[model samples]
Target chain A: MKLVPLADRVVLKQLEAEETTKSGIILTSSAQEKPQEAEIVAVGPGGVIDGKEVKMNVEVGQKVIYSRYAGSEVKLDGKEYIVVRQNDILAIVED
Target chain B: MKLVPLADRVVLKQLEAEETTKSGIILTSSAQEKPQEAEIVAVGPGGVIDGKEVKMNVEVGQKVIYSRYAGSEVKLDGKEYIVVRQNDILAIVED
Candidate 1:
């Protein structure tokens, strides 16, 4: 099943952290702080919140940075996704 | 010293958590999930991001809700604040 966010939330797939440094030494997962970078998979339709219309700004396929401890990690169809509110996103990673 | 956020960051002073129940039973700080509500203090002048100008939508003195684990807890002048990017704010509380 595909992960989808409701309300002002977004579903993001975690981008894999670098496994090696410039020298090419493969580091284990334990050596990395869990990467907070993610690719947006889906976003909730903007809803009226507190009498104001909150609009969805980011689009699918956009990369974003989020607070390290922001969202709940979930697995769907063997893939990992983070479900977090749009505001939990720190910045859109322009590439 | 006051806290000022650079770029799209915002300085927020956390609102107090409730310490009692309807029956007038007092609850300890440990018993409450750390409150995620805050009052905006200073907002960064929205800079050119993604080649698009992101304007400030919320103003100072507005109350907001944030992701529970999003911002870094900071203290200035004996008062507590949270430093987070604008995206880390979920919604403005209309009062």
Candidate 2:
């Protein structure tokens, strides 16, 4: 099931956990920890302002850094998804 | 201690719980229940756009309805505060 955002909303998939431990302590997903990073999957065609359409600044496939506590967590088809506004995106990751 | 947001940020204080029961169940703050409404306390001078300053659309003392899961909760001076972008505000409540 493909997820699509409506009206300036963006869909993000949480990044997979790192294989190595940050402090020599390997952790598993079952630990109930939330990932701080995510990949932008889909974005809505900008929101309307005074009858004008404002395009989104971020693009698909961009790795973004957002506030750890931002956005709503939704489980769709057994997969976790986050829905946040473009403004919630703090910075785009560059590699 | 007053909180002043920076760069289009908005500070909000959660509304206190209703004294009565919602569904014949008395729920307290200790139940870990998150509030769905808040009052806007401070707003940052809007974020820069093309070097132009865009004033915040919302005003102080406005009751805003935000996503139940949006924003980061912060504890400062023993008071709870939420920091969210102006865009995270879904709607304004009218009395």
Candidate 3:
């Protein structure tokens, strides 16, 4: 099933954390305490104000930093996706 | 103590849920399964785009609906607040 975010919400897929911890240890998902990173996959058109539409600034394919506790978890096509508002995005990874 | 969102994020205070439950029972905070509502208390200036600043569409005093799991929990002045981006705000209560 397809999930469409209403307003300026965006759907993101969690990115696998970097392998090899700073201490040179490989951490698996089970060992991680939190998921703080994700990759943008879909975005909604900007919200409407006075009949005018605001456009979203973030685009698909960007890696972003979001609050470790933000967004609703949904399962789409058996994969987990997060639905978050565009503003919840803290920073975009340049690379 | 005050917490400032870095960008277009907003700080919200969770509102007390209605007293009477739909089933005619009083639902206290403990009885509730989720907190899905809040009131806007502080908002950040919109994010920068192409050297121009985007203004936030939300304002203080407006009640809003957000994803049940959106935002980072923080404490200020002994009160708890949730920091979320403006886009995570789904709807504003008219009253």
Candidate 4:
């Protein structure tokens, strides 16, 4: 099963955050910073929000950055995903 | 001094958070949820970010909602401001 966002929400899959330092010792989970980067798995259809015309600019399969501590966490089919509004998406990454 | 957001950055002044309960007792700062609503003070001239062209839809003097735990904190002239990318803005509040 996949997530489909409604309104301006988007579902993202977290990218692997480097847990090891140059010395190759893995840091404890509590010592590591929260991951902020993700790959867009699904995007919501943009529409009117608070009577304002809102549009979605990000597309599926795009790599995006967001605030590390933001967004609601969801666990689906044993996979973790983040659900956030369009505005929480900082930027779309590109080559 | 006023803040000028470069690129898609936005400067916002946080709204007052209610710390008192119905019993008229005040809660500690740590007990209060992080402010997620703000008034747009200055908006960046949105342009290309991460090779994607972005546009600013929120205008000055507009109330907006954002991720509570996100954004970089800035203090200027005895006032506090939050600087976030345009995408970090969740929604524009209506009248």
Measured over all alpha carbons after superposition, the RMSD of each candidate to the real structure, in angstroms, is: 12.4, 11.5, 12.0, 12.3
Q: Can you write out model 3's per-residue Cα lDDT over B8-65, one digit (the tens) per residue?
A: 6899998664521221222112121233456888989776734545568777887665
Which lDDT tens digits does candidate 4 get at residues A1-95?
A: 34546568787887665522332433233433343667898787777544357889999898887754446654444566667778888787675
Candidate numbers sorted by DockQ from highest down: 3, 2, 1, 4
lDDT score, candidate 4, position B26: 23
Q: How accurately is candidate 4 docked according to DockQ?
A: 0.02
Question: How much is the lDDT of residue B70 in candidate 1?
Answer: 39
Which regions of candidate 1 fall more than 4 Å away from where they truly are?
A19-35, B1-95
Candidate 4's displacement at residue B11, Å, is 0.2
Which CAPRI category fits model 2?
incorrect
lDDT at position A10, candidate 4: 81
- Candidate 4 versus the native: TM-score? 0.47
Give lDDT tens digits, candidate 2, residues B14-61.
Answer: 776651233233323333323356789778666553234667899889
* DockQ metric for all predictions: 0.03, 0.04, 0.04, 0.02
TM of chain B, each: 0.73, 0.72, 0.71, 0.78
Candidate 2: residue A31 Cα off by (Å): 21
Q: Clashing residue pairs, candidate 1?
A: A87-B87
Ranking by TM-score: 4, 1, 3, 2
Measured against the true structure, the TM-scores of the candidates, in listed sequence, are 0.46, 0.43, 0.43, 0.47
| lDDT of each residue in A12-93, candidate 1, tens digit only | 8876655112212221111212225568999999677555556777789976655555588888888878898776665554
